[model samples]
Target: MQRYFVAPEQFRGGAVTITGEDAHHALRVMRMKPGDKIIVSDGESRTVLASVTELIPQAMKADILEKLPQDSEPAWSVSIAQGLPKGDKMELVIQKGTEIGAAEFLPFESERIVVQYDAKKESKRLERWGKIAKEAAEQSHRHRIPAIGPVRSWKELLATIPDYDLAVFCYEREGDAAQGVGIGAALRKFREGKLLSLEEGRTPSVLIIVGPEGGFTDREAAEADAAGAVVAGLGKRILRTETAGIVGLTCVLYEAGEMGGE
Candidate 1:
């Protein structure tokens, strides 16, 4: 069945209102008609098996048949903070990152970043990134779309460390450390409840930080370590900036038992 995400207000009483692009896709692209069944999510965990009841120009209405079970979201909320890379690599990161269960994406500017920040094009870039996330979420049957945060500076990103229970900084230097904690070890510590959050009771939130093509400077890595971030090495082989976040996020989900059966 096709899945669509809408605002929570769109799901009122026992019916859902689909409008804009999604409606167009259903009405014109999918050639959906009355009585057609589809899955709809409110983008905040409320999903249902709905049957299309009415269709008109740029709009479609569906009556909720039953509430669907919630199992798509990961147990831990994992956000990816990536230093801006060149070309369209950011888009690939957002799309694949959402599919792999990244709760949010934060693109930042670091010392070694190659892409010069362009203020005029930021809005357009963010809009495109958001659309990619939404489409990826729908394709993956995710209950909620991952959020795309406004670009932040290196210092700004570091200051947000307290917001999460744990922050993992992917540093290439760790690969050469004699006693460095690997990504797996860091996640294992999280699983063991060794990492404590300022908030008393809540599902643990994690932030994985990845640098751009040039990677982070030595001083930057030192600052991140001081900001309560656990420095983790990906592996012996260094991954490209775009691939690092996806790999790190997958490691996190797999550690949390989200990849497959327990």
Candidate 2:
């Protein structure tokens, strides 16, 4: 069944009202008619088996047949703090990151980042990124769409580090060779300490910051480390700015038991 994400308020009593782009997708793209079945998610980990009831002009209304138990969301929430990269790479990061179970995305400016959004078109780009996340969520059967934060500066990004239980500053530095333990060790720390760090029966949120094309400068990485982020590397091999987020996130989710039975 085709899946769509909708706001909770869209479910007005008897049915879910699909609007905007999704409405066009169903009415024109999918050519869906009354009695067609689909899965509608509330964007908050709740979903339902719904059947089309009324085609309200450009919109489509569907009556929820059965409330489904959402099992797609991971137990641990991961927030990816990605350094701004050039061109459409951010779009790729947002799209693939959503599918990989990122709870949210934060784009920041690092010393070596090469891209900058113009003042006139920043909102438009943010909107587009958010849309990509939503579509990817639907396609991947995710419980919720990942929230995309506005592009922030280096200092601004560092200030938000305390909000997470674990903040990994993904650096291609000395790695495990000369620096501290690699990202693998950092993930291990969380795995072994997850039970001890639980608050109100919920796993703590994690933040992983990936540098852009040129990677993080030594001074910048030091600042992040001083700000409470664990500076770690993916492995001995260096990854591009766009590739690091997903790689780091997969490792985090995998180690945290979000990718399988724990």
Candidate 3:
């Protein structure tokens, strides 16, 4: 069944009001009629089965039929902090990141960032990235759309590092996985070191930081290490700015056993 996301306000008294581009898609593109069943989610990690009841002017109404059981979200929450990469690579990052279970994306300006976002273009870019995340989440059957954070400076991201349970910065200088410094080894060390004190069912929150095409400077790596990030390598091969986040996230989810169903 096709799915549409609605706001809490749009869901009233067991009926969901689909509006804007989503409604337009259902109305014009899909040619959906009354009695067509579709999945509707509140974007709060919950989905429901609903049937179209009426098509009003510029809006489509659906009656909630049944709330379906869903567990698409990963066991742990992950946020990607990516340094500004040139061109539309950030869009690809946002789109694919959503599908793979990143909870949020933060774009930051690093010393090596070649791309610059002007004050006027910031809002427009943010809006477009948000739309990409929304569509990707819908297609991936994600319960919630990953949030698109504003582009910030390196200092801002570093300042937020202490907030997460685990924060890893992908550094080529860290070398290959055999050296016991890759994300996999780091995560294993973390779990084994803390299993005694850590409680079960307490999902860990993670932050993975990836730099741009040019990568981070030596000084930035030093700063990140000081800021409490585990400076780790992905593998022997260096990945592109767009590729690092997805690979890093996959490694993280896999390490957390989030790649499998409970």
For all candidates, what are the clash counts? Answer: 0, 0, 0
Models ranked on lDDT: 1, 3, 2
TM-score of predicted model 3? Answer: 0.95
- The digit string of per-residue lDDT tens for model 2 on 117-168 reads 5758889989999989999999999879999999898999999998898999
lDDT of 3 by residue, 113-199 (tens): 887668699989999998899999889998899888888889999999999888999998786645638888878876677533667
Each model's TM-score?
Answer: 0.95, 0.95, 0.95
Query: What are the runs in model 1 whose C-alpha is more than 4 Å off?
Result: 177-179, 195-201, 260-262
In model 2, residue pairs whose N, Cα or C atoms come closer than 3 Å (at least 3 residues apart or on different chains), thus clashing, are none
| Predicted candidate 1 versus true structure: per-residue lDDT over 206-253, tens digit per residue | 999999999989999899999999998998778999999999999988
Q: lDDT for model 1, on a 0 to 1 scale?
A: 0.92
lDDT of 2: 0.87
Candidate 3: C-alpha lDDT? 0.88
